[model samples]
Target: MEQWKDKVVVVTGGSAGFGKAIVDAFAAAGATVVSISRSPDEHGGNGERGNVFSVQADVTDDESVAAAVSQIIQQHERIDVWINNVGQSIRVAFEAATMEQYRQLMEINFYTAVRCSLAVLPHLEKSSGSIVQIGTLAARTGWKNIAPYVTSKHALSGFAHQLRIESPDNVHSLFVCPGPIRRDDAATRYKAQSNGLGDAASTPGAGVKISGLDPEWLARRIVTSIEKRQPELVVPAKARLLFSILQLSPRLGDWLLRKFAS
Candidate 1:
């Protein structure tokens, strides 16, 4: 679909993984991609085969996020899609996880998205732009050891749902919740299995061991959903079934998660 062609798109956490993939896909499809990340990527300015713009911003920092949004507006005049994709997690037992660690995760995963959404809401409303939130199956299924991550994702989904409820006539808010993908970090961590904790995402492919939808594939789905103006969608196809089953029986879903989430 050429709906994204020539459009202005902003992706947070654009330096790597799914966010980076989304930026690449949109740029390749002819959209002007503005990438927001904590640090400037080595490959940021090149745009390589497509149009890519990099904006260094820490989603946890309000001023930084605001400046990045301002820069995008100054350059693009309007934003056609504002995607909130920044997320961070620390795997730790509930008792072991310090309050500071919990706060850190919340700041990055929940508050960051909130700040970005608020910053771009006016722009998105003006352009009738689409707001896509990159969510996780963790939001649906809570894990025992990762309470902080679980809670943050839960909050993220809650925020998205609230936004959907209050969405303007022109603007659309979509949440793309995908299950765990084969990430190299997760795999390596799984291999190491110290204390039975799986995976360390110290590099690319760190999260590739688990079955996952290709980032590019997910991005295409996002684009298609935007064209059709879908409210929210689960990626990898299987997520739809899981999403339905979980929604139908939340307690059962939680039981299954607790059973298998080792």
Candidate 2:
């Protein structure tokens, strides 16, 4: 990957999970990392590196997203990378899931990304920056009990596809579909190191152990793709083949998932 020295990177949902990993990766690559999330204090990047900033914002709210984006632009004057990582997952069955839960999931997983993209598109277009939306394997596959979560991701994936085609100049739009990652472990380590709060598995779909990839390694791949301006990427080599095969024959994929992945 090209050196990110002096670059400005903004990561939403940055207080935890893949968002936190992406922020730290960019910071380590020498970018000025802007951590945007509702709980900025939770993952406030320590000043030891003198390159990380935390901004409080609710991505699902357009005003909040716009305000946060404005603040970043005012402080840094340009954004080199904008990562949409805010999302939520619940494992309730389609009929069992409450209407409110479905709406909330859609807001968090899909609308938030749309709102953030609108907030930053002008700035990103100006600088020919990159936009990365964190996705999941569930986006392409069906989950027995997490219908809402899967549906929301499917919508987000479609939105990312549209954005890539519409974006002008070198303004690259990419989506990352990764499998389950061990968030609690990272959270414990981060807290112990006093760098920031670690990510915990809080969703209804939490403990389902699918094949997991290391966050650090996935972060490296994401950085490399962003630098190269690739349109989409899947973490871990296995995911690419699985995603392709699943895409071609979803019914068989769903059957296998129900038979074994459950």
Off by over 4 Å in 2: 43-49, 185-209
Candidate 2 lDDT score at position 173: 93
Worst 10 residues of 2 by lDDT: 192-201
* Cα error of candidate 1 at position 127, Å: 0.9
The digit string of per-residue lDDT tens for model 2 on 1-262 reads 2478778999887767777888888888888898887864675532223788888887877888888888888888999889988887664545667888878889999999999988899898888889888988777767656677888999999999999888786689989988776666533432322222112223223333455677888987999998878887875556566667677888766566655443
lDDT of each: 0.75, 0.76
Q: Candidate 1 — worst ten consecutive residues by lDDT sum?
A: 200-209
For model 2, the local distance difference test gives 0.76
* Model 1 lDDT tens row, 92-187: 656777889788888888898899999999998989998988888677666555678778889999999999989787989998877664454554
Distance from true location, Cα of 187 in model 1, Å: 2.5
